[model samples]
Target: MLYLAGLAENSIVDGPGLRFTLFAQGCPHRCPGCQNPETWPFAGGQAAAPEQLVERIAQDPLVRGVTFSGGEPFAQAGEFARLGRLLRARGYEVACYTGYTFEQLFQNGNADQQALLHNLDVLVDGPFVQREQSLELAFRGSRNQRILDVPASLAAGRAVWVRARRWVLDEQPPEA
Candidate 1:
C-alpha cells in the first residue's frame, strides 16, 4: 500500500522541466516551519496500490517526467522504487524530494530507500532549516539542503551536487 497526499498534473517548478508531481504521505522528520504541516502524520492520507499510481503517470502524455515530493518519499521507499523503475523503463526520468540529508540517508535509510535512491534521476535532500531559509535556492527551501544528481551519485558511490539557477526572490519585479 502506498500513502499518497495528492498529485499535481503538471508542474514546472518541482523539477528540471514540466512534470507530474506526486506528494507521498508520512514523514518522521517533522522539521520546524515545514510548508506542508498537514502531511506530517502517516495516517492522514489515502492509501493506494503502486500500479494505480503508475498507471496514472503513464497516461499523462504531456509530462516530461515525474517528481515525487513528500512528507518524505523515502518513508514509502519500496513503492517509490517500484514505480520509479517502471517509469524509467518507459523512458521517464524521476526526481524525488527527501527530508534526510544525503549523509543521513546514506547511513540510515532501509534497503528500500537505498533502492529508490538508486532509481532516481535527481534528489533534493536535507531537512528544512528555517534559520537557513532562502528563497534563492532552486527546488529546496534552505541553504543546507542539496540538489543531487542521483544516478551519478550512485555510480560514484557518493553525492554529486547539481547546479541550479539561483532564484532571487528579492529581485523579481512585482507581479501585476
Candidate 2:
C-alpha cells in the first residue's frame, strides 16, 4: 500500500498536460520553504493499494499523465514502483518529483528505489533549495532541480535532460 498526503485530479501544474498528481506522505528531507510541509510526517495519511489507485486514475479519462510528488515518493519506492508499472502498462505517462538526485538514486538507492526510477518516463530531481528558488522555472521550484529523461539517463548511465518541448525550454539537452 502507498501512503498519500493527498491527490489532485486533472492538475495542470504538476506536469506538461492535465494529470493526476499523487502527493506521497513521508519525507526524509524536509527541505525548508517546501510547498507542502504538512506532508512531512510519515505517520498520518490515507493508505491506498496500487490497484485501487489505478482504478481511481481511470475515472479521469482526460488525464494524459500522472505525476508522483512528495513527501519523497522514494520513501515508499516498492509501492510506487508497482503503481508506476501499472500506469505504464495502461499507456499513461509517468513522472516523479524527487528530492534525491538521479545520480544519488542510480548509485545508492535500494532495489525498490531503482525499480521506481526505471519505471518513470521523466523525473524532476533535487531537493528544494530556498536560496536557489525561482519563480521563472517551468515545472520546478528551484534552479538546482532538473527535468530528466529517465530512459535516456538509464541508457547513458548518467542524468540526461529531457528534450520534450513541453518539458524543457532548450532546443537541445545539455551534456550529461
Candidate 3:
C-alpha cells in the first residue's frame, strides 16, 4: 500500500509530458521554503494500493509518464518500487524526485531505496536549497539538483546528467 498525500491525474509541470504524479506522505528532509508543506507529515495521507493507482493511471490514455514526488518517495521505497515496477511493465516512463543524491543513495541507501532507484528511468535528485532556488531551472527547484539518467548513473556508479533535450537544455551537472 502506498500512503499518498495526493495525486495529480494529469500534470505537465512534473515532467516533460503529461504525467500522473504521486505525492507520497512523510518527508525526512523538510527543506525550508518547500512548496508542499502539507505533505511533510506521514500520518494523514490516504492509503492507496499500487494496483489501484495503476488502474487509475490507465484511465487516462494520454498519460504515458508517471512521476513519484514527495514527502520523499524513498521513505516508502519498497512500496514505490513495486509501483514503479508495475508502471514500467505497462510501458510508462517512470521518474522520481528525491532529496537524496544518487551518490548517497548508491553508497548508503537501504535495499529498498536501491531497488526503487533501479526502477526509475529518470531521477531529479538533491535537497531543495532555498539559496540555490531558481526560476529558470527545468523540472527542478534548485541549482544544486540534477536531472539524472538512472540507468547510466547506476552503471557508472555515479550521477550522470541526462542528455535528453527535454530534461536538460544545456543545464550542466555540478562539477565533482
Candidate 4:
C-alpha cells in the first residue's frame, strides 16, 4: 500500500502532457517553501494499493502519463516502483519528483528505489531550494532541481538534462 497526500487528474502543470499526479503522503525533507506542506506527516493520508491506483489511471484513456509527487515518493519506493512498472506495462509514461538527487537515489536509495528509477522516463530530482527558486525553470520549483532524462541518464551513468523537451505550461510534447 502507498500513502498519498492527493491525486490530480488531467494536470498539465505536473509534467509533459496531461498527467495523473500522485502526491505522496509523507516526507522527511521538509524542504523550506514546499508547495504542499500538508503532505509532510508520515501518518497522514489513506493507504492505497498499487493496483488500485493503476486501475484509476487506466480509466483515463487520454492521460499520457503519471507523475509521482511526494511527501517523497522514494519514501515508499518499493510500492511506487511496482506502480511505475505497472504503468509502463500499460504503455503510459512515468515521471517522478523527488527530494533526493539522482546520484543519491542511485548510490544510497534502497533496492526498490533504484528499481523504481529504472521504470521512469523522466525524473524531477532534488529538494526545493528556497534560495535557488526560479520562475524561469520548466517543470521545476528551483534552479537546483533538475528535469532529468532518466533512461538516458541511467544509460550514460550520469544525470542528463533534457534540453529539447523542456517546456513551459501548455506546450505540446513532440510526437514519437
Candidate 5:
C-alpha cells in the first residue's frame, strides 16, 4: 500500500505517449513554486494498493507507459519499485520524477531507492528552481532538471542524457 497524492490516466504530457501518472503523496523536497504543493504533507492523500494502480494502468491498451511523479516518489521507493516491476512485467515502460540527483541517489539513498532506480527506464531528476523556470523546457519545470536514461547511467557509471529538451514548437502559454 502507498499514499497517493493523485493519479492521471491517459496523460500525454507526463511521458512519451499516453501515460498513467501516479503522484505519490509525500514530499521531503518542498521546492518553492512547486505545482503540487498540496502533496507536501506526507500524511495527506489516500492510501492505495499497488494492485489498484496496476489495474488502472492495464485499463488502456494504447497507453504507452506509467509515470511516477510525486510529492517525491523516492520517499516510498519500495512501493514504487514493486509497482515498477509489475508494470515492466506487463511490457509497460516506467518513468520516475525525483528531486534527488542520480549521484546523490546512488551514493546516499537507501537500498529501496537504489532498487526503484534500477527498475526505471527514465528518470527526471533535480529540484524545481523557480528562478530557472522556463515554459520552453520539455517535461521539466526548470532548467536544472534532467531527463536521464537510467539503465545507461547505471551501466556507464555516469549520467546519460536522453534529450536535452522536448520540442514543443508552436505551443502557446496560457493567458494569465
Candidate 6:
C-alpha cells in the first residue's frame, strides 16, 4: 500500500532532462511554509501499488528518469526502495527529494531509508528554510538545501553537491 500524493508526467524541472515525478504522502517534518501542505498527513493520499506506478512511468518513452518528491519520501522509504530497484532494473535513473539533511538521513534513518538513499542517483536534501527561500536556487526551495550526487557522496562518505549551472542556458544569447 503505497501512499501517493500525485504523479506528474513529462516533468523537466524535477530532474535532469525529462522525468516522471511521484509525490509521496506523509512527512513528519511539517516544515513551515511548505508548498504542498495537503500532503502532510499520512492518510491524506490514495493507496497505489508500486507496479502500477512503475507501469505508468514505463509507458513514457521520452522520460529519462523518475523523481520521487514528497512530503518527505523517507517516511515511505521501504516502499520507495522497492520501487527504485524495480525502476533501476528497467534502466531508469532515480532521484529523490527529502526534508532531512544528508547527515541526518545517514545517521538516523532505518535500514530501508538507508537502502533507498543508496538506490538514488541524485538527492535534493534539507528542509525548506523560509528565510533562505530563493527563486534563483536550482530545483530546491531554499539556499540551505543541496543537490547531491548520491553514489559519489556515498563512496566518499560525505555530501558531494552537484551544481546545476549547465541547465541554465540562455536562449537569446544576449543578441550576439
Best by lDDT: 2
C-alpha lDDT values of all predictions:
0.81, 0.93, 0.93, 0.86, 0.85, 0.83
Clashing pairs in 5: none
Candidate that would win on TM-score: 2
* lDDT, candidate 3, 117-143, per-residue tens: 999999999999999999988799999
Backbone clash pairs for candidate 4 read none
Clash pairs detected, candidate 1: none
Q: What TM-score quantifies how close candidate 2 is to the native fold?
A: 0.97
Poorest 10 consecutive residues by lDDT, candidate 2: 167-176
lDDT per residue, candidate 5, 1-176, as tens digits?
Answer: 88998889878777677888999998999999999999999886888888888887787898868999988999999999999988998898899999999989978889999999999989988999999999877678887777787898899887877642342222432221
TM-score of each: 0.88, 0.97, 0.96, 0.91, 0.91, 0.90
lDDT of 6 at 34: 95
Superior candidate under lDDT, 3 versus 4: 3
Query: In candidate 6, which residue pairs clash?
Result: none
Candidate 6 to truth, TM: 0.90
Give the lDDT of residue 34 in candidate 3.
Answer: 97
Give the distance in Å from residue 134's predicted Cα in candidate 5 to where it truly belongs.
Answer: 0.4
Winner of 2 and 6 under TM-score? 2
**Deviation (Å) of 104 in candidate 1:** 1.8
How do all the candidates rank in terms of lDDT, highest first?
A: 2, 3, 4, 5, 6, 1
Q: Residue 115, candidate 5: how far off, in angstroms?
A: 0.4
lDDT of model 4 at position 105: 90
Once superposed on the true structure, which residue ranges of model 3 sit more than 4 Å away at CA?
170-176
Winner by TM-score between candidate 4 and candidate 1: 4
Kindly list the per-residue Cα lDDT of model 1 for residues 46-124, writing each as its tens digit: 8878778778877878786899998889999998899898889888888899998777777787899888987898888
